[model samples]
Target: MSKTPKYFIVEAGALPEIFLKVAEAKRMLETGEVDTVHLATKRAGISRSAFYKYKDAVRPFNDMLQGRIVTFQILLKDEPGVLSSVLNIFARSGGNILTINQAIPANGCAAVTIGAETSGLEVSMEELLSRALSVEGVVRCEILAG
Candidate 1:
């Protein structure tokens, strides 16, 4: 019999609330304020069982992060050639966009997200994100490594 490999959760920074809770719990434990794991979980409003389950599993963003990333959802302006421009930026950044999805603009803007991998190229997530955000007509660009 063979066992499947384990995976870690490394995108907590994108989720501010959960990230903060874990951080606070760590702080409490380090300072010896909570005393017991059960008390710490109660104070943090998280179940003791859940605390144990996710304690070692949860990690801060950019900490021990590793994955072949794909699929990003970008919110853009409803303007001429805005999407093309966005693609151009991705190309320049070495992202081989595999798929894109857009919704009908309801409030004078649209959203586009491209799924690409690092391929043979190597780059930090921060660099990739900065480049995406610098593109014109892009209201926001989020890199999701799922």
Candidate 2:
């Protein structure tokens, strides 16, 4: 009988060099940088056997997030255009806005939650969150769900 595969999110620095090279080979092929697996493996400095062994198992973090819906909860100062500024960040990042909820301001701050489709996003979730936090009047942001 075959065993089911289990996965873990290890930091890039901790991964074996061969695994990283395999992932790079895959990227090269996907991006049309190389026309064939042999070329990709050669460019990435990995043997064809190693590339084939790990290519299916390794993927970039953003590629994993593609096609998923992500929700974020944000705290913002109740100032003019703060919400607009937040939405603009998502738009600029290629996130497809799905829904937005905002509570009435209480004590000079408001809570907002945004849901966005990430399939077409130009940036990763971490980058999106960073951009949101950097917006003027944004107090804090966190992933509510995904």
Candidate 3:
């Protein structure tokens, strides 16, 4: 059986410089700033082999998730200020909240679905999710779609 692919959210400072260079090279090519991978790699100050090695695996967070609308489903303890705290987290993270649909509290919990535009977010989606999860009374949080 084939194993599922695993991914990690790492800070930019922790990654090798070559990965950033490869992402830049790919962007240059996509935006027509460079005509070929050869020139793009040279301009990015990386070797062709290095660029090829990481091109598929390394991507800027903005390139992957920015300008997209994402929906998050959250399970929260039904208590005063719980939803407010979650919304505050999203706002502080730079996500633009578009809409929210919350269900009535039942069995001491409530389900809420939030839609947000991510273009202006200062942090990666993973970080945003982590922050949301860290909020008090948040039982669970997940990206339903994007």
Model 3 scores worst on lDDT over the 10 consecutive residues at 56-65
lDDT-wise, the better of 1 and 3 is 3
- Please rank every candidate by TM-score, starting with the best: 2, 3, 1
- How does model 3 fare in lDDT? 0.91
Counting clashing residue pairs in each candidate, in order, gives 3, 0, 0
So what's the TM-score on candidate 2? 0.77
lDDT of 1: 0.70
lDDT of all predictions? 0.70, 0.89, 0.91
Candidate 2 segments whose C-alpha is farther than 4 A from its true place:
103-111, 124-126, 139-144
Clash pairs, model 3 backbone: none
Using all chains and alpha carbons, the TM-scores for the candidates as numbered come to 0.53, 0.77, 0.65
lDDT of 1 by residue, 18-116 (tens): 546766676588679988887787788777776776677565443343345566788988999888887876677666777888889869888776777
- In candidate 2 the C-alpha lDDT for residue 120 amounts to 86
Please, what are the lDDT tens digits per residue for candidate 3 over residues 1-146? Answer: 99887777678889888888898899999989989999999999999999888888998765767899999999999989999999999999999999999999999999999999999998878899999999899999988877
Better of 2 and 3 by TM-score: 2
